[model samples]
Target chain A: MTRDDLDVDPDELYGRLKAYEGRTAASGGTGRDPVNEPMIRHWCEAMGDTNPAYPAVAPPTMLQAWTMGGLAGHPGGSARSEAYDELLALLDDVGCTSVVATDCEQEYPRPLRPGDRVTFDAVIESVSPRKTTRLGTGYFVTTRMNVRAGDGELVGTHRFRILKYAPARPKNAPKPEPAPKPGLTADPARRPRPVINRDNAGFWEGVARHQLLIQRCLDCATPRFPWLPGCGACGSLRWEAFEASGTGTVFSYVVMHHPPFPAFDPPYAVALIELAEGVRMVSGITGVPYDKVRIGMPVELEFLRVDEELELPVFRGAEA
Target chain B: MTARTGDELPPLRIPITRTLIVAGALASRDYQDVHHDAEAAREKGSPDIFMNILTTNGLVGRYITDHFGPRARLRKVAIRLGAPNYPGDEMVLTGQITSVAEGTAEVAVIGKNGIGHHVTGTVTVQLPSDAPGTTDASRTDAPGAIDAPRTDAPRTATTPDTPR
Candidate 1:
């Protein structure tokens, strides 16, 4: 109930939280609303997904969306049990009051469609022992929810996990800097590496030689970028390295900003370049402002020496 | 039509904004205080209201289908979350085709935000039969046939088939 309750034994508290494992978090729960087109439209709109397959059958990912109880808190009635409540209350009493959802995994055996009445039952799958994180020390509470249709046919299962933790620093303390994440560094040596394997090793070798190579199916003559072993056009396994003209146009691109990583500058451009050979590759776009890099902008290929150990084939676009 | 083994989809950059975060949560019917209430989120240890898992799932599904085409049916999506997707950050989603059989393909997807990877998972998508690169025998043409219109993202390479 208060920070004064800090005297609670860690082991005892963890044991109590762990006791709720396997208990029903929700049972015989009917969705407050059935799967419908409006929600699907909203979801698609918010996500900027324009796939026409939607509004006919719901997105499989929406399996859990239909079962969510929003701000109104399951207006029909509470399908949640007191065990989950008591669990959270227990954590709150010890000042582990902050809660952040950390993970979710869902499997859809069948597609959910509009007009299907949804029902679900959830159980407290597991509770981890108290662990400290950059966010703070707390237990990870995981729940598995089985969503079904009105006919009782299981549609999907959603596993959701949350970290119920005490803030690592008090609110009154000096503002804490963003936590350092792994694989993020200012050191040039820590730059992200490309995945190299036998199939594409030759492509990297070409980059090392300042020769931009596109894989061509020797059998069909179809050229492919990113160097796949077989041809999608003819299914030919036979291929050869063909030199590119080093000319391309930006097909699409994005500007990176936020959560700065030390190895690179922020607000830079990453582009999908369509080669004159009719193949496309994703690489860094240089010589242009992040915002000025537009679709159809002409660019020329260049091998950028990222570090002593690596050379990447990036494209240079003209500044607008 | 180029959904094939070992093929990589072009990365999609998603700008993280408060509107997108709150809209996504609301759209998913997730009304958790930490997802829409910034003060409440900070109180709960997050610097800001963060994206919800359902939203992340939705985004992942969208990412796959955006490249594979509209008719692509997602059979299964198994993902593990890593870092939080806070507002003011961006998530770049990159996917690689890992396996292909018959008319179905499995892709390994990673969504990395400012701090680190926000989500890592694999998606199994059922490509339309007439779709390009549907393994053996569906190969409709040869060589210059590469310019055939496809259902996938525009201008992306049709890295059709790789050794199964």
Candidate 2:
């Protein structure tokens, strides 16, 4: 259904939406919690990111957390402007009642320290004209928020965008594609290729020859996978290519499904393999359905000829 | 992770899972049902549970700092989401050092999902005074078979996060 269902004039509606371009979306909101270590720890643990620089300060990404209203949202309606709600209501008055958040951009001027208090004010930055997406036709609503600390320090700026539109009609059933094969071939655009450069050319060469190799720093005796030119632990260019045992366990994994790519199937598991030698590398896994791929599962490396021109190192479930 | 201007940051691959979406949402105190409940997501017109913006923001931050190392400070992280990162999808994050000047470097980043770009933006990082100045000869950081860090060339790939 299009705007025919609603009696609002196109020009009038567009004018009304445009009128809110610079209007305040929300303002004068205080964070429910201060920048603290517990939330930082939980966030890092969930993301599997363990950079030592955190907790002393919050993750740069957590720039929005300090200003969130939580499950119930902002304490009151004091911050939100009536115009923002009116624009949304007008969109809903039409047939576009569905909503999906598209993306967000955050700019941090300074990291938030543990004791800093955060306050913010947000504005309706812009409202896009009617647009069509893979999901459906809708307008993109963007909000710009400025966050500050207790001492009036500008901590960060966050711009968040969302699409409020009616979802597209689902299509009729299409023929099922064949299961992913060892020699699946398609246009090169659809397949991911290894970046071959001088720094790690040897690693790719080893893969072509069916050898899994890791870089070992001769100066520090430390082994690293994914071939770096120098050892980060010790600044050393002296290194040698070490053959890997081709055996490892799935330290963690994710099953991919969308932002669909051509010639590739979704709901497949991509796993991080921690080799028996104690280094980790990312690769694909087979032999089990995506949901069954789990951490601690044993896997062995196998070179798969993905396409005529491409051969990749993949892992196979060692058991089951 | 540390490089001169025009160097490509090592790519980071993160698999978008139901567990990741829910845990990230809850962890960030975003209790929206769409991020954690498949049925709720379906009701919201999504195929399944999808990732929330807060989680995406967190991951992007992690991606930058992980490559630049702990000392690299994020002066600004401006990201725009393109695709909905639902469960069972993988995000390959790739970036390049667009410029470096006055103790700061601007990195242009694009995160593509299986279908296409999920997020695209620039990150301005305040490099530490005593950081390593890695030359182009080194900096291998991909499961990089598919994604060599984008140099001056027009490269469109990233690191691997899974064995498959």
Candidate 3:
């Protein structure tokens, strides 16, 4: 099919978007919360950032975090203009539906202190014509946000860019293929082996024998997976292996499709299974199609012998 | 040793997991479905949910501060994303001090995963005049020093290919 077959008039779309440039994307938008220590603490804990500078003055990089609307969305319903919505809808109408953030540039002029209220304004800086990117063909939309403290002092400026595009069609639909037979010369296309070491060697040994193991703290009896050297609960270095009952529920799952790997096929379900023992482990979910996998699905452990040298612990649902 | 133009920071290998991806997004307060909802991500044409730019920004910030000490102020951070960071993968972050002048150093950083380079950028950090090691020492008694800052000289990874 030619470019015209996609039903997109490149010139007309470009001309339509030109009027949106310099238009206000957001005006007088208030932050969801004032700069405070608790939110800063949460962010630091999650990022493993223990910088002593935090909980004093907020991290300079967190300038935009204050402005985000949570799962409930912005209280005043987005605080963005109708023109911005219309602009995005225009792209969607032309089959450019996928969107990915490509770049961000931020400048922090001054520290954001605790109890500081923030407000911001954003303008649609520019919009590029349809261009093909490694991810797909889409238009690059850039917006500039000016963040100000309650005192009306400009604290930071953020330039955000996103690519709204149609995803590239896969060369071939991904099919679930059986593991390659045992081979020689170190097949690069084979599944990557799990890294085994002194701390976790026992768990792998259990897997080879078709037994799923969870580390148990000898002192506190807390069970943990992705075996750690010490128990997080009791801080004990001594531990014993507790064999799992092999049944669990899918706490969460994802389907892999992009940047395909050599050893594994695409469109496969990788689930975080919560075992009956109350510990979670990351493994492949078998016996069901990728789309069929769901959170809370019941599953049972099974040893998948992918090759002569490798056998992995995988879970299969009841349907399989 | 003071940071020079050619100083190479140590490499950090991070295990990318679903927990980290979700936690990072929540930490950033980004409620975008593609960052956490796999089914929604697939419906939007992605094979899986991926990391958000804000999380990537946080990680990049952590990389710089982890090496340059807490006192090092970040003047600017500009990055461009390439390959997406999906679960069940690993990202290795490496950096080099491309230039150092007037208490500021420009570090060029690259984070690569199994697919390819996930993020490429330059971080402008304001290091003390003497060095990051000495600067971290004087603040050991600061009220919120939580834990001692890492004052060790950057250790270059001899075997970059080894999995963590």
Looking at candidate 3 chain A, the ten consecutive residues that score lowest on lDDT are A175-184
Chain B TM-score (model 1 vs. true structure): 0.83
Model 1 per-residue lDDT tens digits across residues A1-320: 12322447988888888899999999889887888899999999888787788999898888878887877868767778789989988988887887877777777888888889989999999999887766677788999999899689999888888888787767655444544423345334368888999989998888889999889889988898777778999999998898899999999998875334557666588899999999999999878778689999999998888788888889999765
Tens digits of lDDT, candidate 3, A39-154: 89988876667778898988777877988887887786887878888989998998788789988888878889899999999999999977876556888999999999978999
Q: Output per-candidate TM-scores for chain A, rounded to 2 decimals.
A: 0.55, 0.52, 0.53
Candidate 2 residue-wise lDDT at B12: 71
Pairs in steric clash, model 1: A1-A93, A98-B44, A186-A262, A232-B160, B1-B132
Model 2: DockQ vs. true structure: 0.25
Native contact recovery (fnat) for each candidate is 0.59, 0.60, 0.49
Each prediction's TM-score against the native? 0.65, 0.63, 0.64
Q: Score the docking of each candidate (DockQ).
A: 0.25, 0.25, 0.20
Which regions in candidate 3 have their CA more than 4 angstroms from the true location?
A1-5, A170-320, B129-164
Reference-based lDDT, each prediction? 0.80, 0.75, 0.79
lDDT of 3 at B109: 84
Query: Which runs in model 2 stand beyond 4 Å of their true positions?
Result: A1-8, A76-78, A170-320, B132-164
Looking at chain B only, the TM-scores across the models are 0.83, 0.78, 0.80
